[model samples]
Target chain A: MGGLQAGSVGAFKGRDVISILDFTRSDLEELFEAADWFRRRLLDGNVPKLLDGRLVALAFFEPSTRTRLSFEAAAKRLGGETIGFTSEEAISVAKGESFADTIRMLDAYADIIVVRHKYEGAALYAAEVAEKPVVNAGDGRQHHPTQAMIDLYTVKLLFGSPDGLVYAVLGDLRYSRAAISFLYGLTLYKPKRVYLVSPPQLRIREEVEMVLRERGLPYREASDITEVIEEVDVLYVVRIQRERFPDPMEYEKVRGSYRVTPELVKKGKPTLRILHPLPKVDEIDPRVDSMPQAAYFFQASLGVPLRMALLTMILGVYAG
Target chain B: MGPVPDSELLVRKIREGTVIDHIPAGRALAVLRILGITGREGFRVAVVMNVESRKLGRKDIVKVEGRLLKPHEVDVIALIAPTATINIVKDYKVVEKRRVKIPRLVEGVLKCKNPTCITRKKGEYIRSRFRLVSEKPVILQCVYCGTLLHEDEILAQVLGEQE
Candidate 1:
């Protein structure tokens, strides 16, 4: 594994990552502990030389700007090589091959498979078929488990468990699978309240609502950001839904509706933390990126260490 | 067509045939949607819908008489209704009885939802997939668009489009 080193690969030996919610509370705590180790190792310039000859396969059928590069970077920093197709055009998949066959073919070359397809459950299905660890990068509008992991890490680092602290998830809750999965995960920690802020059409999903309700987790809906600003501990935001708002007129109507500007964050208490899943058009104002409340930049940077920690643990290469 | 058979709706016993039993209530018609069985089938197909079953509140049974069903057709039987039990009736005797397993994906269970999807919008043939999210209520996916639709959703979309 040229993308990751052999020495630091601990606890994470041979695990399939189909969904973020699949992890038990213990499972995550273990990974976070490993991440702390990876972060420290990376900080000291003596990174773990685990996964020396192992290869990481990245088969992203859909578009991903940050996730694709970050995984490769994580692998390289750990002393492993990265390979695999970014899209269907590069493989026999476009020539009409079954996902089963494509995965079986890649299984021969890579120890771990990281896939981001447009179909929901694609990664889960792939994990069932492949004889290696499968990481779901993004599946349809259903899940982005890795992003949720990094988000949770950032959140944990910020308010120190902030369990019972309120989080206001604003913007496109409907098409934002990342937001949906993250909200599902938040239930595990027992937050005080979760304000599912969205436009009327972008209501929180029934499945997510059911999961939270079943767990006896308290959550409410608010269409306006003002309703959440005063009391929110964390402002979790998702990307704009350009795909859904096809009508330019309707887009114009909602263009500036829920933006989290630096001015807006400052208007709230100084302690309010703003986090985004990123690649934002206008949901979060750029000026807010520099605000004290802006934790997304730090959150984005943490993805490397968090994922490195997960990869290291899944591969199981404890230090000598 | 004719007011179902006196014995059943679409089938009669044959020298050698496959008996599909233990289907969920009102899904005998859905078995036809799988396309393994003929609409105007040459072989006699007996459909017993809404019949009482201890396991299922009410169930369906399709008995194909005379010619034995091919293995691929048997596989399709498993894909259509996981609850369906297949019995190899040879020489008018129940040689084997077993429950069917759900296939990972249905080749063409129904129509894809996305109107703009290349498979649905312009193509003469469209292949939709179902990932079996829930067993009681079957679910399939539009390969092009990531839509989690119930089996009834597929029937509504497909049958509605045909109408």
Candidate 2:
């Protein structure tokens, strides 16, 4: 956090939050500092009404519950309003309206747009169409900027910094946007090593691996989680995305391929923390949820303040 | 330049058209497709393939009669044939000749191979767009999805084969 003061938040004003790669290390540091400030203020029962008259449009072309609610909750806590549809079927898109038209409508209605879509570049397309700042809640198989922010903040909260930690991103590396964004976020810092664990069919994309190499980040790819289970400081898990598989048989073959259990947790260092962008399906055994290593719930809760930090900065309302 | 080989002389010189010489061997069809010169276009086209050259070992050359290429068409040619030299023939003399230079941005020539990319949506009316990210290896990144298209993908898409 060295020269990154609250005033550094000015750079983010009216900027689109579409990809983690767009952010620099100091930009992340500034955001994390703001999130930390919001976290403390919330605990003290002082909810700032900084965005008193602003409106946040949630244009989710795909279905989502946790992400939609957290954004709504975040905006409400900041005394802002939230609007827009959760699914394509719930809006004019069901009548065959174009994605750009949908985004244009949201832009007309709100100050900032939070869009989630099944297509990979839908958020980028929305940002292109809309006048308002666009935040990508998630995009197909690659970007989830705010989720990655909360995740890095969680790591910072636990280990005091995201740097110099050995991380293994387990499960659907190919199809999981959260996992891929987390990987992209890791490139912003210096990690000791990262183990990409997935079945060969679901291996990390060559393009992503190329970026990781370009960043000079140390990494290894493995088929099994146990290869680095004992050495990793953080095990970031994501569910196998069944819907993303073009063939049902391919989905069936990799389903339940990796699981975290209490016995499996016992093999790791006591300080090892486990994280998942949840609504998981049979990936993490319910028994492990009670363990000290289960930091996913705490990670999920931090979504509020992290998003609050983002909204305030993007809306240009952060006086500090 | 010593002498033109017998194979190179098979397609006689054009008096008033364009000669695209020194294309990477076996890429003449791709160059034709980039130029939209399907045999249906009815222009007198001579494709000489695998001609021996000191600089390129073996290369393909395309000589078109009664046709001049548009700038954008030449730009697309530069994508697949960086070593290609475009010579505007006038009265059987090479009036203008210049090696192809890759453009800073390319549009509608190559499709993003990413199946889930928004630009691939059926009714979106979005044209494919790519930025020239690297010239040596010929990398094109989709402006929408940020998916990279290397030389092979670019060639395939330019040849009208879907990935």
Candidate 3:
């Protein structure tokens, strides 16, 4: 499954990595291997402490819960010290320091910067001006490469491999950057089928469809989650990002197109695992959380290993 | 070639000035609306419209005698007509023949990005700073609301705002 993506990035020298698409199959494979290696060392109690003196700085211009804590956890586990803002309310950024200058200032102090900003391409902009390495924790509604990495890693861990798998991605395809990056990342593989379940107004973008065409990955969409739930090997759910939408009234119109519950899974396949890049509002009912096939927790758990792999690869902390 | 056809652009040269050539047709007014051109008496101005250009289908040129367009004005013009070239003419010899470069931090080229932020749907001053994120792909960031503006959409929107 990992081919040119593995190698095009010859020896990772801590470059400015902003998107998962920048990585080849070879690069992903290397990342996965390095992360799995780190995961093994911690579990075995002979941890090598490869990045003891390294410092990772996080600058988040928006509110975050899981992403902020999870990225900090990933960096700390790598034997690196971390410092940053979970929210922008207290920073000098609130007093009108432009993003470029802030990034430039951080470049002198920190070895790597993991930033989440509200504006699209802000991560790319930070990566552009900074001489040190920068990673996109998530940027606006544009890309979430690390989260997509965790999602794919969870699929691999669960099913052994991602080859010839059919998955149903439900809810808010248009405004959900997670869904967009997930679908974009998945399309790089030859998935058997991808059922994009969203309302009529929130279909996967044509730009997304064009990338699917480029990779020759097959896909289709439906308004009903029930229509394709039985056929999928996995059911990936995403919340409609109401905050990303400028108008609240538009969000009201498309809120209930798909709702997952234990009742919805009554006769569902035992092997059909459900995944959500979460902070889920009502899309996945709480009753569904206790079910045997609920993999969102496990999905979230995969973030550590995946990001450990990602950080090591990008920073060259691992034995090459 | 033959006395530079029509030659209505016969304003006297200055020791130092900028000549903006090949602006798209019907945009001379917008360019003139830029600072120091409309009511200021010192800077001599030359406006030529309906000129021939295979690239623009039609063109206009504004030559400012004894002055030059500011960095802000160049950013404004680059938003409208990327092909419009700015020449720094000193003593009738040309230098710096290229399209105006949009600055990374822009002021006075646009308004707020929010629909409800009192700029999109109203007549209030559509003024804001912008940051250039990508040059080839051309994404602009609004300073007020931090929205990334798709390149041509805002350019077209500003065209409507001018009228």
Candidate 4:
């Protein structure tokens, strides 16, 4: 209530969530506050029909689990109807329709569009073609703006602030869209430092590095996670995606190079929190789940309210 | 006198066309490719490479007779040769002389090298777009994929067909 006034929601109305860089610190704060309000409302059993009579078109051209379902749940919970395809096969895309045409078609039916595609910048392209607000759920290894919001929300809930936190992004930095999104989200905050922990081949991409340099943010790279695990406040882990690697042999070498086991978690700071953009493969050990540091499940659950906040705000329905 | 200086003899003066001067050593070919100049009849082109220059130790010059580049075409030249200058020659005189500056946004001139870039996907009408992020190294960030393309990558990935 103190953060997202009706005027704050106005800033998000009809905005396209293509890149986390598009949002400033104040904008993200408003979103986090809005998401918090929704979470509280859900807990109190007060389901606001903020998005009632609206329709959400989810165009997931690639495979998705949490992102697609969470958006659907968020829309439905707000009393809005959901439409669109979860895969290319479910839609006319299988018939070889252009992406622009598909987006234009979806724009006609839905008040807003959430797109997830395997190609980087697909959401930006869709936003160009669509008239309605376009929310990027995920776009290849480029960005996942909504996931960044959820991740930021989870971190904010745990730390009470986004300032001065030392974050260690562990694992495949080059290929993970979640990591890229998270890094972009961190730019909005005054993070002390971001340690890029990955193999030589999988170091953070130059585009992200350029953004960091432009912002004058401090960051360092290390081959091993243990070097920075104890010093960081949050450990954001990402899986080494096999499909992203063109060479199978290179993927084999770095596949399981870094794993978050109980022992690794013990090396982390007392307040260290582990978060992964779910459907994680072998990056995080199951034994570490019972620990207080495992915030991924809660993080995953936060997606509902986070996306709800995004959807309603973009649709200009959130009166808060 | 005896023979024009080697530098002066490199590229013949254009009566009425565009002269791209001070192109870094050997990038005239890239300029031609970007400008869609194929040296076909009716369009006379002279490309002089590795010519001595006081400012650029070595330079390349392209003189296209009877052709004036569009604004976007000049942008492509700016990307390829940041130090190059564009001169519009008309009636045997340099009518307009201006240095090429890389535009903030480049659209459809180059292709995003990332195979998974939306612009690269088939059946998608998304035009390849890029934002000029860094000028020192001449870095281009694909507006769609957020991938930073360097100079070498730009040359190789520029679309063959100019729209």
Per-residue CA lDDT of candidate 4, range A1-320, in tens? 01222454366887888888888888888988899899999999897998889999989988889999999999999999999887898888888888889889889998888899888878887877777878888888888888888998899899998779999998899899898889888888889999999988998888788888888767888888887788989999999978789899999989888899999899888889999998889889999999999999999999999988988888778877
Model 2: share of native contacts present?
A: 0.73
Worst 10 residues of 3 chain B by lDDT: B116-125
In order of TM-score, best first, we have 4, 2, 1, 3
Off by over 4 Å in 1: A1-11, A85-102, A243-253, B1-30, B39-43, B46-63, B66-154, B157-163
lDDT by residue (tens digit), candidate 1, A1-320 = 21223454333567677666667666677777777788888889988768788788999887787898888878889998889878888888778887767877888888888998766556766776778788889876677888888888888889888587889999888778788878867866879898998888678655556556777768888989886688988999987566645476876666656778776787677788988878888777778877788888888888888878776666676442
- Mark the regions of model 4 whose C-alpha exceeds 4 Å error after superposition: A1-9, B1-15, B22-29, B39-61, B70-72, B155-163
lDDT of 4 by residue, B1-163 (tens): 4857566675667799988889988788878877777777569888898888889999989888888876566867787688999989899899899999888898877877788888889877667888888788788888878888897677555533321
State the fnat of model 4: 1.00
TM (chain A) per model = 0.91, 0.96, 0.93, 0.95
Docking quality of model 2: it rates as medium
Clashes of each: 40, 0, 9, 1
Reference-based TM-score, model 4: 0.89
Report candidate 3's fraction of native contacts: 0.00
**Model 2 Cα lDDT, one tens digit per residue, A1-320:** 01123554466888888889889989899998999889998999898898899999998888888899999988999999999887888887788889988888888999999999999888888887877889999988779999999999999999999999999999999888899899999999999999999988898887777778888778898888876799999999999998789899999898878899998899999999999998888999999999999999999999999999999998889765
Q: Which of 1 and 3 is the better model by TM-score?
A: 1
Q: Poorest 10 consecutive residues of model 1 chain B by lDDT?
A: B117-126
Candidate 3's C-alpha runs over 4 A off are A1-11, A95-98, A205-217, A266-269, B1-24, B31-45, B50-155, B158-163
